[model samples]
Target: MRTIQPIPFRLLLSAVLLAPCALPAQPRGPVGSVRGTVYDSLTRKPIVDAVIEVQATAQITYSDAQGRFTLDSVPLGVQQLTFSSATLDSLGLYGFAREVDVTSDTRGVLLTTPSFGTMYGRLCATAGSPSRDSAIVFGTVYDAASRTPLSKAQVSLRWLQSSEGGKELSNPERTTATGDDGVYGICGLPADVALTTTAQHDAIVSGAFNTVVGPSRMLRRDFYISRELGQAADVRTNATPSSGSGIVRGTVRYERGKALPGALVSLIAGNRSTETDAEGQFRLTGVPLGTQELNVQQIGRGGVSRAIDVTARDDGTHDFVLRGTTVLATMNVRGKVGADQAGFLRRKQDGMVRVVEREEILKRSDIGSALKRLPGLRVAQKLGGTVIEATRPMCVGQVPIVIDGALIPNPRNTTTFSVPQALSGTTAIPRATTTPAPSRAAQSSVVSAANNARVDQLMVNDVLAIEFHPGPASVPMEYWPGPPPQCGLLLIWTVASNWDK
Candidate 1:
């Protein structure tokens, strides 16, 4: 979990600001006292505890609570001044320098970081004004083993704004890819709210980074990820398991060192499955590297699941302490979680909820075809992707999609795919074509590629259950916020998690 620190980024940037801006010389001066204030140029927050020093001299001082600093009897005629701090370094606010002229007792001197307004000019759209109201989050993604920056890695940040009534309101999520420098920046985030972040490169993922971003211009967050084992990959996959995967290993033990032999373990994402050995040890190889929900169950006992960050190096063993429960009459041969089953049955009792069982789900090939089979539902094409819509006369907007326990957010400002469609289909977005394909295979591949880009489809085999609420009245009161998401809701319980509501 260590990171490569003191990245020299600040040193280089500071050097640029210190050199050759052509400061004209002032009148004759002598040794005198100098006073100054330091604050973050972006957020305008006074940065206390910063070390301010006169370069090439022993006179060094630290900024007080008000970011004020003073030096007495300094030989300060056009002297170089530098200011820095550990907080500034951690926040990416360092790398600024100033030269002060001291003819007599100097006052009103100021130092600050570069303006974020000029730095991120019109980079992203914002729900509010791009300036002041919205903020930016940028950071580097590094490879843990190499201690080097990783490019093309994905970093995501999401936050929510809820009403006083506890009805879920706006939940916006944004994601971006790291550049060649292994740095990624997401702009236009709402300020003054708590946000959660995660990074992923191929199958390797980082643990969550949570922070309450103030109404600042920017914030920096970094991630470190280790590559998966070269030889040990997903054993459950039919095709050759790629080297870019990690093993999810753990032990299922009862209290007092009792190993629970024959206990079943599975990834909620499905396909990968295994059981504990005589020692109550279980290893699930080749879990697609990222954050995934894992479910564990045993007969005559309960079940438990946790969202795990799958990576090459994870001691992420699930150690549950579940007391025995009544035997499940419908325990599957594969050791399905009793909680998952009971929860599904309980949800079926609701008149407003429409549940699709596994058998019917397995029969369908794609989400579009599967959803259309249900009553009061239909599929429509939008933004070059498929959208699930409620067929009710009064409720005619796109249905909000929820996968597992998370809601897929659709922001008004996103330039890329609307992530709510992230579950609508399983295919990529279609690319622009100059002409129709002459061969059937080529046409099929092209069509699939388009579907993939759309992020609006999913293969039916990956789905275990589907719940549809045709209107706000149909949605359970617990999840509904009074007025928003009026179109209805679609909940997909994938093989990836036993989470049900």
Candidate 2:
């Protein structure tokens, strides 16, 4: 270097060309990393075996059982992180896309996933008999694009009954994992009603929905899933003659003023009948549009018939009032229990219990008003709608509103229902009326109701009975399925009649 002659042009160019291959690769400028844990937004529990991938990079990793993931050698700049898992997708839980910065080694990043809407379909071998005892709903999960059945796919089946007064039913029986055949099934399902199925596979897009186990004795419904995130599969089913139908809504009441719960409201010419709810409300869906005959009957009050004009859209409300005494002559109380007797026995059996009958519910326009009649329960207005609170204070998540046997999840917490401010009377407020602050319990119920909006979906006329237990100690074993609520429990039972023909 001290006295060397100048290098020739060709040799200098050659050295310059080889320079990039030498010099220790410039030390890579301190490669960065990213780490985080994935969690279920609803359950707030860590997800296990979830996968994490870096966009625009070869770095990818799977989450440990604790839902923890780590990626090293990430480029030092803004980077997008994607998460996925099969277990989560089957339950309708979907991961969120996150934009993360990798300027340095990052840690403790929390990613939450929300549940996607469910889809519904039916599986049957033939169209003649849709109901089969011990019938199996089996299907294969395949790559949407590749058309290959996925292995280790998770298929879950849940009952799709309406929550008595809560959110949609989420009663899972068991989870079936696909094997090398990529096939799964749930047997011994009740053939009387439809069932819901969900599918999930690692890094594969999943879907959930209620499925109609059609009459086909050995029908199969296959699901093709995609790798794209945040998308739910659309529900598909065979069309029926009554596919394009409408709904009929209304209330049945005693002539005096009381709403009639438990009254048999049937379509005269059709094989469809349902009992009125605690609010004396009733809804008949899948009703063919046009003129329909309605028949209302109660054991003691007798029966009445009327004609209703229905349309394909915009549900119509009808009110019926019977001209008879509310009291039924004391009979042996045989056969099915009468609506009035059901309400009376519920009250007579327990002094602490507060019963909301159809008659009372029908009197009120909203569920909040119907609940206000319960002792020690207060209803207050909020930004969304009226919230129910217990006069006796309780801890967090103590009071759970149960419909039928399923607990109603708070609508606010679920994506299923959206509480319209309009329904809660929170949209337009009058300056003259000053609303008081809601109690903690009341605020919680309101939020729960708003979040779940199950109460709002309940037509007073569809409720058969409602029972309020002030606290855990008061809840009956029959009504309390899982753990007892810490605060109190609201029980709602809907009318389920065997009128389907």
Off by over 4 Å in 1: 1-29, 122-129, 161-171, 228-501
lDDT of 1 by residue, 410-438 (tens): 32111123333334322222222223223
Among all candidates shown, the one with the greatest TM-score: 1
TM-score of each: 0.43, 0.27
Residue 415 lDDT, candidate 2, scale 0-100: 17
Per-residue error (Å), model 2, residue 397: 15
Task: Report how far off residue 261 is in candidate 2 (Å).
Answer: 40
Off by over 4 Å in 2: 1-132, 160-172, 229-357, 360-501
Residue 198 miss distance in model 2 (angstroms): 1.0
On lDDT, the leading prediction is 1
Residue 83 lDDT (model 2):
75
